[model samples]
Target: MRSLEIHGIDDLRVVDRDDPAPGPGEVQIAVEWGGICGSDLAYWRRGVSGTAVMSHPFVLGHEVSGRVSALGAGVSGPGVGSPVTVHPARTTGPLPERLRGRENLHPDLTYLGSAAGDPHTDGAFAQTITVRADQVVPLPAGLDTRRAVLAEPLGVAMHAVTRAGDLTGAHVLVSGCGPVGLLVVLAARDAGAARISAVDLSSPARERALALGADEALESAADMSEEITVAFEASGAPASLDGILRHIARASVVVQVGNLPPTPISVTLGPIVSQELEYRGTYRFASEIEDATRLLARTPRAEQVITHVLDLEDAHAAFTTAATDPASSKVVLRLS
Candidate 1:
């Protein structure tokens, strides 16, 4: 089998590797479609940041959909040749904190494509990948592989929207018009948000956001109206962060779904204390992949989020395009 490995910063090589057999409780997926996530590009361009970095040569993909080629012992449910999307999360049952529905707070959680733990369980940027059977989410018939590849990122947006509480009839503002941010718009619209506004610096992305269900799109975050009751900060830009704080109505909820590096930025904490705003931090898909998948499957124009596709051999070109191209929303590697 051949796998694309990121040796270090800006170093990606397609190299030969041994085919992995499904271990007990695992399922091997013949990689069909691999979505190029922003994090993947970060790994390629900057090596590592936030929580994910390459310490050794390893595969780099998490948003994946494929057919079941083989199953490990004790794995049932979906048989071989079944089309499926995967929730690339690894966790040991429920921790004390997680048992209370706070699984994201698991004390010893490690993510796929991370430098920590076994770097051997390579990701889906290859001919095949073996994940825990439980991590796999078998999609129903008629879900195209290109659209199914978006399940992971959509899950992130779905979880963030649900966690941000009710948005029905609320004026919502989503900052950042990237894949996740655009998904946030879709989710918010599905949740019955009214007057949803998407903010981004890219004009083309703003247009895409409008098409995705944003009532209005703006290039300047500071120009956002002060009537926004919920502000989703998906752009890691410091200016966007400050703008969200200023634009959000009093007593509104501000969900930080974007992973922003620690930077010295000033904000008015007096409003948070006096007006009582909700500032929440959300991670990737955790316990809500199933719900997110259902939402994505039912949502109209879900496939429009995917803007480009390439063969597995063009993974390098896809990565480069994602890093430099704002017009490309979701880039997928079609393995089949």
Candidate 2:
């Protein structure tokens, strides 16, 4: 079997590895497409994402979809040949009261391709990878694998919208038009938002957002003259987050979906205090993978967001395209 490994910053290679067999309660998948996420780019460019730094070689992929090639003992649901997408986070430790129903908040969670652990957990970017059966979600009937690969990021967007509560007939603003930000636009539209506006420095991203469903696409939130009923911060920049806070209407909600750095950021809290604004932070996701799959099945335009695809052997070029190509939205690699 072949696996993509990131030995260090700007060091990625395709290496031979022993094929993994499924263990009890796990399933082996013939990995098909794996999307390169922003975090993956961060790791490739700097060997770190937020506070998590790579201390050893790591496999860098989490948004993946594939077909079941073999099943482990005691796994009964998804039979062989079933097409599926994976929920890459595995939680450990007892759940706290607030996190009991929300497993995404589990104090100790091990995520695939993450540097959070000392010995990084391998990710699904190989010819074949084994994962717990419980983490796999079957793709909807006839859903294209390319689009199905988006379920992970779409799930993140859905979870952000879920944190925003109901957006029905409300003006919504999405800061950052990256892959997740663009999907946030689609999610907001699907949730019955009256108007969907997006902000990003990339013209191509803003164009893509408009093509999907955004009513307006601005270069930055500072360009917006009107206040939004709800705002989604997906740029992970202090300036973008500050801009969103300035443009949101009083008593509105703001959901931070982007992964900000561990460092503290200074921002005005006068509006939040005086207006009684509701600010929330959203992590990976809870149970929105299924919803994201269903949403993708219904959204044909959503597929346009995938701008580039490459073979697994070209993983280095794939990472470069994803990290440097301003026109690229989602860059995926075909493993098999």
Candidate 3:
């Protein structure tokens, strides 16, 4: 099978590797589409993602859609040739009682393509790969790989909204209009946010936020509402915190979705203290991928979030575009 691997910083290779048969309780998939994520771009550009440095080469994808090619022993359902999307997380062990419902918060939890751990879990940007059967989810009747590829990132967006408690009839603010932030607008609307506004430095990104669902998109937080009921900061820019906090209403919630630098940067905490704001940090999703898949199946608007689809051979261009081009929301690689 052909796999796209990061040899080192700024070194991306589309090399051929062995594709082994699935072991027990595993499912082998022939990848159809793989979305380039911010992390993927980070790995290619710097050989690091947050605190995880890519000490060795590994496949670079987690947002993928494909067809099941083979099921291992004792794995029956989601039969051969079934179109599916994968939930990329794998908990290393049983969750403690305190973390029962929140499987994603497990300390030992790992994800595909993440270099956070020693063995560096491999990702799924290849022609063929195998993963645990439990990680696979069959696509709904009307969904196809093109749209299904968004389930992972959409899951991230949906989970952020879930962290905001309830947004029913609330005026929501989204800081950052990148792919995930754009999806957050949809998630907020789905949760009954009466009005949604987004802010981004990029004019194209702001425009995209409005096209998707945000009632308003601003280039800066200067003109934003001071009555924001909830704010989801998705830019991962530490500097963005100050701007977002300035407009967030008293006692409102702010969910931080983007992965900030491992080292802390200075930010004013007076809003949290003076206004009694509930500042929450949301991590990667738990089971929301299921909801995301179902939502994508029902709505045509979600598909518009994908901006570019490039062939696997054009991965260099894909990663570069995704990293540098604000006009490109989500860039996908066609594997087959």
Candidate 4:
């Protein structure tokens, strides 16, 4: 089998390696589509994202859909050739004190393709990879592989919307037009939001936001609606956060969904205090994959979210294009 690994900062190598076999309660998947995420771009460009660094060779993909190739002992739900999506959460033991019911809160939690483990428990950027059977969620019937690849990112969007509570009848502002941000727009609309506004620096992203059902799309936060009652900041850019804080209505809820680089923002504490605004941070889905899948199944434009597909052998090019080209919405590397 062939495996692609990140040897160091900005170093990607495709090498022949032993095929992975499933352990008990695990299953081996023949990766069909692996979507490149924004975090993956951060890893490739800077060799680090958040607090994790690529200190050793690591596999760098997580948003993936595949068919069951083999099953490890004790796994029975999906048989060979079943379409599935990887949930991407690897836990150590029982959830920690601060992480109870919050599996993702454990500092030791390992996300597939993240620099959180030694040699990084291989990811979906290859032909064959094994993961716990429980981590495999069967794709909904009629869901295309490209759309199925959105399970993970959609999970994040779902988490963001969940953080804001009921969005029905509220004016929502999603402060990013990336895959995750666009998904937020879809999630809000599905939740019956009265209005959806998407903001991003990329024109293509803004256009996609509108096409995905946002009532308004802007290239920047300037002149945005002051009536936005709920905001999801998925851009991670400091300016975006500032804009979100500036435009949200009094008593509005703001969920910081994007991983911003370590930069300070000019947040007005007055409104947060005087208006009793609710501010929260949303992480990757802890145990929400099931619900995310159901929601995606209901979305009318689920398949249109994917913009490009590439062979797994073209991982480098795929990563490069995602980084340099704003037109590629969701770039997936197909292995089979």
Hey, what RMSD does candidate 4 come out at?
1.8
Model 2 residue 262 CA deviation (Å) reads 2.0
Best by TM-score: 3
Total residue pair clashes for candidate 3: 0
Residues 15-70 of candidate 4: C-alpha lDDT, one tens digit per residue = 88788899899999988788888878888898887877778777778988888999
Give a tens-digit lDDT track for model 1, residues 112-189.
666656553467788888888888898866676667888889889988998899898998999998899999998898
* TM-score on alpha carbons, each prediction: 0.94, 0.96, 0.98, 0.94
Candidate 4 regions with alpha-carbon error over 4 angstroms: 96-99, 263-270
Which residue window of length 10 is worst by lDDT in model 3? 220-229
Q: Rank order by lDDT, top first?
A: 3, 2, 4, 1
Per-residue error (Å), model 2, residue 266: 3.9
| lDDT tens per residue, model 2, 94-211 | 8899666688888888888999888898888888999888899999876878899999999999999999999889889999988999999999999999998899998899899999
Q: lDDT per prediction?
A: 0.81, 0.90, 0.90, 0.82
Over the stretch 194-288, how does candidate 3's per-residue lDDT look in tens digits? 99989999988888888888999888776778768788999998778777776677888989999888887988778888889888999889999
lDDT of 1: 0.81
After best superposition, candidate 4 residue 281: deviation in angstroms? 0.4
True lDDT of residue 27, candidate 3: 98
Task: Tell me the deviation in Å of residue 131 in model 3.
Answer: 0.8
Error of 1 at 29 (Å): 0.7
Name every residue pair that clashes in candidate 4.
none
